[model samples]
Target chain A: MSIPDTTLASAKALVAPVLDDTSRAQIRAERMSAFVRYTLLITVGFLMLYPLLWLVGASFKTNSEIFGSIGFIPQEPTLDGYRKGWETSTPYTFGRFFWNTFLIILPKTIFTAISCALVAYGFARFEFPYKKLLFASLIATLLLPNVVTRIPQYILFRDLGWLDTYLPLWVPSAFAGDAFFVFMLVQFLRAIPRDMEEAARVDGANSLQTLIYIVVPMLMPALISVALFQFMWTMNDFLGPLIYLSSVQSFPVSLALKLSIDTTEAFDWNRILAMSVLALLPALIVFFMAQRYFIEGISTGGVKG
Target chain B: MARLQIRNLEKTYTNTFKAVHGINLDVADGEFMVLVGPSGCAKSTTLRMIAGLESISGGEVVIGDRVVNRLQPGERGIAMVFQNYALYPHMKVRKNLSFGLRLQRAPKAEIERKTAEVARILEIEPLLDRLPKELSGGQAQRVALGRALIKQPEVFLFDEPLSNLDAKLRASMRVRITDLHKRLKDQGMSSTVIYVTHDQTEAMTMGDRICVMKDGHIMQVADPKTLYDRPANAFVAGFIGSPEMNLIAGRLDGNSFHLGAQSLVLPDELMARLRANSGSVTLGIRPQHLRVNTADGLRAVVAGAEFMGHEVVLHLDVEGERVVAVLPAADYADLDRGTTVTLTPDPGQAHVFDQSGGNISLSTSQ
Candidate 1:
């Protein structure tokens, strides 16, 4: 958003002094800009990861140590809570919960990315009847909250007797195509000059061929971003599985971890804290694995993340 | 080799934007046709429609012997070079060149052979292993060309391909492209080509015949010399030249045209073109054709001078209108700004246009 390199280029061009004239101001300007960029980068870098660092440290800390300290890293670290969270008999059933979450997330991430990218290609590169209408409808759904349609979706799934299956969790997502992701991808696809697609087309590619051979290959960044979002959301989802899935085996990790709230004894503070840390792992892993795709100004989406 | 026949081609977007109006053109088996126009003039749009990239709202695009309007672009057997050289960022130059071949399931050795051949032709053999981002603008441009060239399609469409290169490189590339055409012709490959560029110089130098376009319509189509010498209309005359043709308002009063307080004898051929119009007519003349004479024609006051190394362009104010005279650097040695000189108009080189900007050929009626 700051457009530093571009701004610098334009500024250097537009603000050049007369050839015979020299000023200290140019050097000062260079030094000032470099200083500002470094300071801003370091500040934003710390701001982005400091909280996550604290959470990781807290996850490794004992309950007493966590409560007593505000320092980032655990002074005395232990993996006992992680060990407790990984056990099935601990009431939280953390391992099974993680597996359940992953079951939805793994498929959801892949299918959502494919569907969204496919639909986005259709929207971006093709012209057909009702194209404007279809695009408008897709964009309109972006603003429509899940809650507004959740009740109806629940009833429909129940009537089909799919309420207990992962179908209701991951199936709608496949068709829903993550409108935001689709929209993001569509925008990225639009930025690509039609010439590449034309070159593909003239070389004997049909629409699908162009999409696969040219368009999809070009949209790697956007697709990865869409995949990352779907992975995180599916892993951390609380509401859909909560309402539709009733069976303990079908419950995702987010819902299963909520079982840490005690119905019989005093509130299990250690387990709650431990389960939260374990829950953060999937998203952290996802972000780390997909960080390479989040590079900016690479002819795809000019997004940093 | 293929003939490209476009008959009554039209493209209208759903948003009610009509990019290309009805257009008709036919190319011989290996004719090099260049489409020249300003931006948004529908030249590229017309090319895309022919390539089947943009769906035709109305018209027929016949390639070789097949009506390919509804056919997919790939089946049309054409390759295109784009302005920005839209190379695959993830792929090396070799892979970029061979992408289409691979997609069509060509044998690996054949792909390698074609890639190597194209790389060698473009002198990019060493850079084939490098990514597009690592290449300079000229290198990237050659890669795009090599990618298109390796396909060996029946038709080649260049969409402002040299617009991205620096001045020196673009000039050199044009010569190389012309050389490539000759080499291809010698190889007995007679592919039809349609190149699109807004640069008139490129069109003039590269085209066998140029189709001058304006506002989605082909204004004129002619060989480069004819386009320069006998422009079909005022628009074509002005559009085809650099430092553009200077058109001035004048009156056709008898056998000679009157400009301000000066009169030049019109050629017998052009004199017959003057109609009995109620108002003033416009006179069209190229700067290079106007010679500085001391004895005849309109009195011009030199206003400015642009010394272009080889040629010095002497800007003149004649009858409250600006006209430029491009003379060899030595010719203007004795002249300075504000030097009053009479210019001799060469009637044979003059183009007469009516108020509507249409060419009115003089038939020597007088």
Candidate 2:
């Protein structure tokens, strides 16, 4: 092959070899695709992150600045909200609210882990009569509205004379297991090939033995994933706390955060936002702390459905 | 270690698909019994039934003196290594090894001893502390084996344990597993081992007795050499060898038989059988049995030849029928395609089967 007789200037003046229709269309399509992707991503990302950013911004703002306009940064930032939200609030202090919530959610999380894991183990490994039917029932509970359970549960609690205590939320977790959590665990369990369990069985492992030694360990990602999920969910649950408890003294952080909403307290924006940020602490700490486990778990067979 | 007997075992699912039809097999103590077939032949299902993993739908699995039909796998004294090397993913190799011991509530020191011994035996000591993810495929398989070995079960069941390994590793592991069986036998641990594999090489290389299966039915049960040399049916003959046995179609008429357009005389006994019996008979010949030579013999055309270092595989056109023939390197050094060659099958090397694929004695093969 020999070069065409063309000068550098002539080559420079040429029209990029007059790209074939295929290459021209490909280049145009690639550029259009890149533009659309970024536009969609940034637009949706901005919308999702906007409210969290606003909440953080409000946490630092004074009452005056908060009411003025929504901005990323306050004109004159102040720590009065933090002071008031953290310690200077009303009848039920945020510290006490924090303690109460900590006390309840802590026990609730542990109970949820235990009950969910045990029930999940049963659903995952065992093959008794009505096994599939039992599993189906557990999954069915996840679809029913939470409000439907509220009235009947409240009546049961009313008859038991337990309304202003954390027993209502924490006790149930010890009994029937979190259906959603169990479902996630069951998926993870199912993914573990039966060979492992069979190997264990030959090794003298009965059903419970297999569950504890082989099956449970393989499902760590899913279990920790569910535990983390449960921690965040229970920490932020307000409706359950509201309906079950009456006294402000026994309120969780979520119910405490809503205290401003209940009282005629000038709609305490500074305190509400500060407490909102504070309420996020458990979720954030939980998510960040177990985030790697969380991601690993969900990316595993952490039955998202 | 004990004798294992599967007496008319069956497996039927809720969908009413009977994966394993009722089949009976016996494994003598210390014998390596291989159940081999193509995929979906229920060889694995049959193994699972013996392992107490699949609920036996209709019959009892007897091990030693006890019938283990209702026993859990743990209680059945059977250990199984699976096709996927299903080690517990979150557990370390040590944990995987000791899991069964721990389940039995064995003392810590004993569990440690056995775990160490098996890891040493499998050459997986360095992997004891690493999780399943951290180990290589071969190491994970060793850990799965170690887990089963540590249990000290009476029967060792392997469900294509080498299927997950690469070819090189598979060959190496095959040797190791065979050595382990030999060592176990020498130590007087008379366990009846049942191995399930689709790979004919594994079955041929490892099994004391290979039970060739098809569509949930046992085609034949014979020692490896016998299975290879005298397969009971067309499926077994074709399935047992890599290049496969060649099956050529022919017909009977008077003294000479007609194959394509050529005439070949039958053995006097075969002619006598045709005179006595009824219907058509099929002739089966292994690839190695049919050789192309320059001597006066059965005539064939040279189709093609594949040169393997130690040997060459010649694809011969035997009267318009393509059949593979293996020759030693020296004989195939200069064999060419399209040339006329004399073909010869070693007497007593070919098997005769009826049209239904059942083997027949030469005296009755019609």
Candidate 1: regions farther than 4 A off? A1-85, A90-93, A263-268, A295-300, A303-305, B15-19, B267-280, B361-366
Model 2, A1-305: lDDT tens digits are 76666775587567555656668899999999999999999999999999998998988898878778968688778888888777634675788988988898888888887788889878777778999898888889999888788889899988998888888888998875578888877788777667677777766777777777766776777878877887888887878898888888888788887777777458778888988988887789778988888899988663221
Q: Each prediction's interface RMSD?
A: 3.6, 3.7
Note the DockQ of each predicted structure.
0.34, 0.47
The per-residue C-alpha lDDT of model 2 at residue B17 equals 92
Best by TM-score: 2
The CAPRI quality class of candidate 1 comes to: acceptable
- After TM-score superposition, what is the CA distance of residue A180 in candidate 1 from its true location, in Å? 3.0
User: Which run of 10 residues does model 2 chain B get worst, by summed lDDT?
Assistant: B270-279
